[model samples]
Target: MIKEIAILVYPGCMGMEVFALTDLVLMANHLAKNMHPGKFSALRVKLVTLRPNPVAIAGGFKVAAQRLRGKPDLIVVPGLEVSRFGEWDERFARLGQELKAIRRFHGQGTELASVCIGSFVLAEAGVLQGRRAATAWPFVSEFQDRYPDVQIEKDAVILSDGGVTTTGAVSSVMDLGLHLIRESMGSAVARAVSKLALIDGGRVSQRAYVDTALIPQNRAPFSTQVNRWLAQRLSETYNLCALADAFNVTSRTVLRRYRQETCMTPLQWLQKARIEKAKHLLELSSMSVAEVVVAVGYHDLATFSRLFARETGQTPGHYKRLFQGKRVATFPRG
Candidate 1:
């Protein structure tokens, strides 16, 4: 039987999420039909929308999807562009109708999958209740607070439980689609599709891509003060006591406020800033690994290297080489 995959697009949806999954699914179907001949069945993918009208997305373009027709085998909900904290709440609030639709489709046995912040919609629909899920890292804390019963795996590239699959960040759309293809069409077809799509088949975590500095700025007053202080001195050693003294607060207060804002301890945040600076130096400067380590405020080379590897999933040297425009791998020209 041909598996039906319905990708739901919405107003302000992130186009990359929708297209990435759609293209991968289409490629999987193509590879299955051509290579395996009659050995495997193909997949039918549809761009579905709640309303039949054209919808404007994050980019400047508009898309028109078929008004969700009959229930499909799976429903992939793509995320929207959320640049502010309130945007998350606002989007879900305005999605009452869409939420109802999702619950209805799920009740009819349609499996639900979400990409990036799309998991928020699944949670709002109550489909992710009592299930393990994942979403873009920045929203993990908030998602947890809103859906207390749902388990959020912030680092996982893709997570599935009880027919509800959730993927982290926009790039995970490819990984999630490939996962589904593998499950339905077998590993062989999944590999063929991955190669055809030029995506890594082994990507299973989003930790390497997450930049702690790029995590949305914390809005709390104390967090803001701490952010300013850290920005000015990422290359210097800092102590929580000194920071608290400088800000006229107790050490515990500093820790509490920073944790509330960034979801990391003061020391962790300092390390994150230093590592981010080190990355910039590695990518742009002629400094050696040892020089780069000291430049990022680490006096001990071993400690810096270990911390860098742990946070980035790559050694300092490997990361430099990877980002220095060196060709790590070459693919046949399309």
Candidate 2:
């Protein structure tokens, strides 16, 4: 279990990232206390500073670190502003020393992690060389340029190399923490923590949206025609022969071209499109399960349930319930 956690704070650090990490940690600890009772306890977290004085975060927010008496089981480095100002240099140098000390601690079973630009500090400490890591997409080029040995993967929201972990941007840090919590505790505990934090663990995979540019454009003539035809008739069920006829090709040729372009067969793509439409309706409209099934071109509830769960890792009803619950929680009570 992750009993002790330390957060590194320095001048010009991103306040939101630190707050998000701390919030998730607090949620995990709360779940631990509730689940374990007297057998185990909550996670112990502390905000520690390399300098003796309080650190001023970006936008003039000052945070005072409580003194830590011992080494933490996990140390987290939040993003810092890399500037050339005098205070910036002082804090950066102190952060470097702090990272060095944490690396030394890692040599003795402690784990080191970072969020967003914090990876730069870990890289500077020589802990990320040749390690698979990720940071904010905007910093991907700079990080690669600065540390050529580090394998920068911008597509990943979080990457772990041995004991060192790095996450992309401030929001993704919550996913990283949740992942660590799941690994340390169990899925049930992590899910409870996510519920308490009002965070949807499923959104972690949406990090792939940032890599949309990496997807190759669909330029194949048959694929283009099939996609266009399918887009117009998403609410209609079409057989493979019908699809092949529309494309003026044999079924095998159509299947091969579809798979090559979209990495999915014609029927699979159609089902995915329907599922996507169903998800949108679930989010945007108050449709019943039966109605949604028809709206998404599925007449069979069992098949829809199986496909929805397979694609989203949750049943359609469960997804609807979670989404509705989130809206109810966020709406202002009169």
Candidate 3:
């Protein structure tokens, strides 16, 4: 069985994702023929462009593509290179045709999938509304803020719901490609392709890869002021009375106002801030876990360790191990 796929291209799309996805699909076909010839299945692919002319992708690269050549079995939306917040709207405004194409294909019963911030397009097209989806980690808050009706699977590397699939970050294209092959050709062929390509198919969660410093801050004025207070005194002992006093409010009023603005109590917000700080020190500084605990204003090492593990889905030592010896590693100069 050969499945038809229309890989959508738009301006500012990540070139690596476009090539990597096609490369993975080609490898899957090669592996399927060798490993599962009897039940062989493959994807017949085509590149579709939103613009009539050549698509200008990221890093000053241009890709030539044709318009959609009718409905396909699946439509793949690769990630885009998003430099900052608020730029998403500007970018999406130019993707009117591409967004329409996505909506049209979905209405024609075609399965849809997006990678990284490409989920933004699907959400903009309204197909991801009322469905559980996953987007790039740093953009989750932004995504949530923009599309309040969509359910974001915060940690999953890939999520599928309502005939739509979404994957985290650009690198997740490998995982998404393997998943497509596995759905049609079976896991044996996918496993063989993964082994040949050195792509790990067992990736399940993006939890450990999260960097809280990249998470957007809550914009509410009260939440803003509260966060400012926490940042200035991250090493100070917590005292609700003092915090309330700092804001010139009663403790009960502080709690009520904080919950109203941030949906979390004052203590919870402070703990989150502390954990983010601890993660940074653990990665960049040579601080011991005990020292990190004290640096985050927690005297009890065990409690801080547990909180770190809970927030990051890995122990402080384990998280540090993942980044060991990389601090001084330099990249080749361009």
Candidate 4:
């Protein structure tokens, strides 16, 4: 059974990604303690870092490391924002040494995991070769370009290729940890941990946003045209073929271009745009559902309702009620 774990921290790391892993692990530990006292002890966790001080992240957040005496059973490396202006910062060189040392510990049979962009660190170490991995969708192309040997699956939430696990994004780290708990202990334990953490395992897959296929390289022209067209004809009925014809392209080409640029097909994009318009009308205006549907270019109320529910995970009526409730809560009666 895996007991000890460590989470690597460094400057430029995403605060939320690190917390997702630690939160899930801590929840699993808590559930273990509640289920059987003294039977299965909580996993040991250490925040490992290069320096003996706290490191600053992108959004002005800093995290301190907890010193470790020995190698842990698992080590989690959270993602960091890459600087596009040039090569990785010099601070990453020191982090590289820390990663190498952690790998040496992993070579002794300790399992390794990474969250979102943290896969880059693992790729630099040359450990992910021939391994299937996943990272944030936006970085998928860059990651593949940098590490061609690694089989990076774009659709996976949490990929485990021979004990080197990687999650797609920050939120997916929570899913990854729950998966680890299930593997180490049992499904029962994982379910209990999910309950305590208030996470739905089923929703984990739906939240993933990466796509690995070769997408269109340029999107400015397409996005601009689409936005203008969408804005002017909010009440007009639109179709994929019509939009494609307007752009003088085939439907398939339009679909591919849209997917590459926005991570959504034309239809999905239309629905999202419609939903946003509907939300504004519901919140800022006194438009009813029927009027909102017409305003947002939808003729069928049923279709609009279904699409809205799928997009937001709540019925339009329920969303309206919740939004209204929040507004009312903010402005109480005198």
**lDDT tens per residue, model 4, 245-283:** 888999899878777777776666666767877876766
Model number with the top TM-score: 3
Candidate order by decreasing TM-score: 3, 1, 4, 2
- For each candidate in the order shown, give its overall lDDT on alpha carbons: 0.84, 0.76, 0.85, 0.73
Off by over 4 Å in 3: 37-39, 219-225, 327-334
Clashes of each: 0, 0, 0, 0
Q: Per-residue lDDT for 1-334 in model 2, tens only?
A: 5677888877678888788877887777777777876644666678887776677877778899965447787888888875432233355565666767766776777788898878888887778888998887656766786889999877567888988889887777788778878876778888998888777676543332332233334578877789779879888887889888877889999888788876788787777778777776776788998899998788999999999877666678877775653543466789
lDDT of 3 at 57: 90
- Root-mean-square deviation per candidate: 3.8, 8.3, 3.4, 6.0
- The TM-score that candidate 2 achieves is 0.59
Q: Give the per-residue Cα lDDT of candidate 2 at 65.
A: 94
- Tens-digit per-residue lDDT, 1-334, candidate 1: 2388898888788999988877888788788888888987777788988865798888768898899888798988998887776566777776777899999988988888999999999999999988899999878878988889998888888988988899998888888888989988999999998887788889777666666566566677877778778768777877778889998989988888788876888788778778888888888899999999988788998899899988888889988887866656878998
TM-score for all predictions? 0.85, 0.59, 0.88, 0.65
lDDT of 3 by residue, 143-225 (tens): 89899999998888999997899999889988898898888788888888889888889988887788776766778998789
Judged by lDDT against the true structure, how good is candidate 4? 0.73
Question: Using alpha carbons, what is the TM-score of model 1?
Answer: 0.85
Candidate 4 Cα errors over 4 Å, as ranges: 19-27, 52-70, 81-94, 102-109, 137-155, 206-223, 238-334
Query: By summed lDDT, which 10 consecutive residues of candidate 2 come out lowest?
Result: 206-215
